[model samples]
Target: MYVLIFSDAGGAAALLVVRGCHTALTAVVSNRSNGAGGNFFCEYDATHQMSNSKGELVSIRALVEFCSTTNCNSRQSTSANVFNDCNDQTTDYLLGNEVLNCYECTAQQGKNCNEKDRKCSSKKYCTKQIVHLDGGFQLSKSCSNINVLGIDNACANYDVVTNPGGVAVHNKYSQCYCRNKQLCNSGSSLGVVFTVSMLLLVHVMSTVVA
Candidate 1:
């Protein structure tokens, strides 16, 4: 149990008389505080942190230094040659692999973070990109056309925030999901704005029939 409390004592009045038998275990209910009790202070290990399945943000799960980007944040795979499935351990705990992809990214489309580029090691397939949900970003280059590419043109005038009837692509090269702004029909650049609003509504109905 922490090797019988760091080998059974050495001041804090002999660890407050061995495991605080007289009460005083003062902070090691850990989230990171190795600073006041000299020599690897430790406690509170709920296996660190790993929350998912609908809380949204998927990566930061821990282990090692109680990992949230520590105990050596294992930085190697941007798509390190697409093999799949990997688990690690040094101090051992670096958590979060209950599954949803990125064991080196074959992609369930979450955190594939560019998969070591160079077109993902020449087509082992990650084609090096994973950004999704309409800034649209992920491309390994296979599908040349079938539509579904929106979110460019600077957010297409920034109106909808969440699901305002599905269809958007405001123009970063913008090309699909055109359901509004009159179906984004600028193909003829909106036919000169509908022929100058139909010639200014036929000259305001010929000046109200003269």
Candidate 2:
């Protein structure tokens, strides 16, 4: 099992747990943005931790990219290689096949983003992320083996608007995961397809606790 923890300067936190991946590979990446900054850290159980200073989004994107590029099943016997062998391997071993095709794109392509699809293994989900930053929002789609730490088939949204040191700063990040169909991440509002009730429940629980 792999455990990832993300926390920002504003006291917001999120946890992601990835299971059935290779046993040896482990990594922890963290970043501090210009204003109010954020930190992302993840660790795999059975090996040493690798750390990076890049942003949270970049860290996750790197993991997804790594999964897409490498075949973990072929490297299981080798020693842990930080970010290289972290892709989930158990599903492919058990199912013996790929299951879904997800729409793939990067935020950098801007308006000229191309239509590309990636095959996802079983237990993996098609993922879409929308990030609202200073000027506007950015979108990216890919396949991910990581799920929200506790909730199943859920979407996560974080909206933080803070005036730190009297400077206005706003950051909004949202991600959705779905495994029901192929190319499920093609819509603008893909997050709505996954249940947001978990978020609502968390809000209610926090309110009651306070």
* Cα lDDT computed for each candidate against the true fold: 0.20, 0.40
In model 2, which residue pairs have backbone atoms overlapping below 3 Å?
A: none
Q: Which candidate is the best by lDDT?
A: 2
List candidate 2 stretches off by more than 4 Å: 1-98, 108-110, 117-123, 162-165, 188-210
* Structural RMSD, model 1: 26.2
TM-score of each: 0.14, 0.45
TM-score (C-alpha, index-matched) for candidate 1: 0.14
Encode model 1's per-residue lDDT on 37-68: one tens digit a residue. 22322222112111132322222212111122
Instruction: Name the candidate that leads on TM-score.
Output: 2
Model 2, span 26-132: residue lDDT tens:
12121211111112222122211111222123332223212212232122222235344444422322222546667766554246435563433343566777766
Model 2 backbone overlap count = 0
